[model samples]
Each structure stands twice: as C-alpha cells, then as structure tokens.
Target: MRLLGIDYGDKYTGLAISDAKPSLAVAKDIVYGKTRQDLSKYMQEIITQEGIDVVVVGMPLGLDGQPTQQTKKTAKFVEWLRTVLSVPVEVMDERMTTGAFRAEHKGSARPQRDDAQAARILLQNYIDRHYDNHR
Candidate 1:
C-alpha cells in the first residue's frame, strides 16, 4: 500500500509519501492554501496522481496527552478528507516532529523544507510502529 503523510496547518500543510512497498517516507511538498477546501482539493489531486491507498496525518497533541486546539483542527481536516477521498485516513502522534526538524536543521534560518521534514518524521515513525507490528 502506498501511503501519504500530512502535516496539516492553517496556512501551510506539508506532505510526504511512501512507495507501494510502504517502506520509507520521503518528503514531498508543502501546500499553501487560503481555506481548508482548497487544501483538500489539492491533496485529492496528489492522492490520485500518487495512487495513495492511505493517508497518515500528524496529530499535534499536547505533551500532557490531551487534545489541543490544533489537534481538534487536524481531526476536522481528517474527517473532511475521509468524506471526499476513498483512502483510509489515520492519525499519528506528532508532538515533537517540529522540534525534531529544528534539531536536524539547527543552523538554518527558517528552512522552507522544515514542513516536509516534519511530515517525513511523523510518517516514518508511523510506518515503523504499525508496519513492524503487522509484520
């Protein structure tokens, strides 16, 4: 199964992808949108072109293990995506993905690639955890 990873945000959303083998997650693109509808349509096109069977969206939960405002927003986006797309949507914890990205690019001045990197980190983590369990 091919997988797509999403780092959903209000202004910019990052995307990553996995091969049909569902092996490694690779950074794809960062999508900018004025509204959720625009982002959803753009993601749908990517899913069709990439033949994505599943989508793993990063859920930014609080360190206290509670849902934050951003988490609620991501959930809404996931729900909307499920309605419009046929692919199965999943959530993966992304509490530290941004911090991890910053650690990786410590010297950079706001790297434009950070978003995609965050997506890759979350997606790879999910793939490793879930796929390993299944195998």
Candidate 2:
C-alpha cells in the first residue's frame, strides 16, 4: 500500500510520497496553505489525484516529548483531514526530525522540501515499526 506523508504548516504544507516498495519516502510537492482558499483547493486536489491509501502526518513533539504550538495545529489538521479523507490518518512522532534535517543539510536549504522530507521520515519510521510488525 502506498502512504502519503504531510508536513502541516500554517503557511505551506509539504507533501511526500512513499516509494514503490514503500521502503523509501521522498519529497513530492509543496502546497500553499497560507490562505483558506489555497488550503482548501490544494489539499482537495492532492487527495483526489494521489489515490492515497494512508496518510501520515508529522507531529512536532518537543525535545522533552511535549507537544508544541505547531504540534497542536498539526493535530487539528489531522482531525479535519479525517473528515475529508476516506482512509485512515495517522500521527507519527516527528521529534528532532526537522532540526536534524536542517543540521544535516546545513547551508543548503529548502524549508518546505525539508519539512515534507521530515514528514516522510516520520511516516517511514512508523511504517517500519508498526506496519511491518503485522506482516
């Protein structure tokens, strides 16, 4: 099954797609969500065209394992997503993923892309830990 990863943000939402074997996840696109109109159409189009089976959203839990402001926003977005998407929406721990990505990539920057990549990492981790466990 193919999984879609989403990095929910106030201004933009980063999108990523799981590889064919579902072993790798890669950045696909960035959707502008800074405005209500943009947010509505962008996400609707993605769900329509992607044929997504599972949606994994990144949760920015702090270093101490506490939810941050963005974490709450992400959670709310996930909740709203559930009402729209027929498939299940899962929240994955995204602690340190974004920061680590920034540090690793250093000078080179693609915040939106990196955000989506972070989502992919979160989803990949969840898939490896839980989905594979059922097999």
Candidate 3:
C-alpha cells in the first residue's frame, strides 16, 4: 500500500510519499500559493500518477489538543479533499511535527525543505503507529 502525506499550510503545502511497502516516508515536493481547488486537483494528479492508496494530512491543533483557527482551516481543507478525491483521506495529529523538523535541522533548516520534512515526520509517525499496532 502506498500513502501520501500532506502538510497543509497557508502559503505553501508540503508533500511526502511512502515507498511501495509503505515503510518509509520521503519528502516529495512543496506546492506554493495554490487555491484550494487547484491544490486538490494537483493532489488528484499525484494520486493517479503515484498510485496512492491513502492520503494522510497533518492536522494542526493547539498544544493542549484543542482546535485552533489553523485547525479549523485544516479541517476545511480535509473536507474539501474528501469531496474530490477517490481515495480515503485521513488526518494525523501534527503537533510538534514542525518542531521536530526544526530540532533536527537547527540552523540548516529552510522553509520549503522544513515543510517537506515536517510532512515526512508526520507520515513516518503514522506509518510507525500503524505497523506497531498491527504487529
């Protein structure tokens, strides 16, 4: 099973893809300044091209697990994705995903690269949890 991970942001969205075995997540690309419809369409193209089985989006929430404005925006995006995509769209808690990337990269971090890395972390976390539970 293949999976696509998305780190949705206001200006730029990051994307990641899992290997065919769905074991490792790799940073794919960063999409900048796209409308919601355009983004969804782009995702659809990727879904078809990559043969993705599922899409995992990073769900932004407050540190206390409460929904914030960003969380609401992400929810709206997820909802929009569900309406347009054929495959299942799921969200994984993305708390500290960016922090994790920043901590690892430190001074070397670039905004575009960091976003993709954050998506990679989020996807890898989901893959790990899923495999661990199944095992």
Best by lDDT: 3
Better of 1 and 3 by TM-score: 3
Compared with the true structure, all predictions reach lDDT values of 0.87, 0.74, 0.92
Worst 10 residues of 3 by lDDT: 105-114
Q: Residues 15-132, candidate 1, lDDT per residue (tens digit)?
A: 9998777778999999876487777777789889999989999999999989999999999988888898778899888999989889877886767557888998999888898785
Any residue pairs clashing in model 2, and if so which? none
Off by over 4 Å in 1: 108-110, 133-135
For every model shown, what is its TM-score relative to the native structure?
Answer: 0.89, 0.79, 0.92
Query: lDDT value for candidate 1?
Result: 0.87
Report clashes for each candidate as comma-separated counts: 0, 0, 0
Model 1 TM: 0.89
Report the lDDT tens digits of candidate 3 across residue range 1-135. 999999999998999999888789999998989999899999999999999999999999999999999999999999989999989999999999999988887787466457888899999999998864353
Q: lDDT tens string, model 2, 1-135?
A: 778888778876777877655677777777664664566466567666776678888887888998889888888888887886767888888787777668778887666457676766666776787655453
**Highest TM-score scorer:** 3
Instruction: List runs of model 3 lying over 4 Å from the truth.
Output: 107-113, 132-135
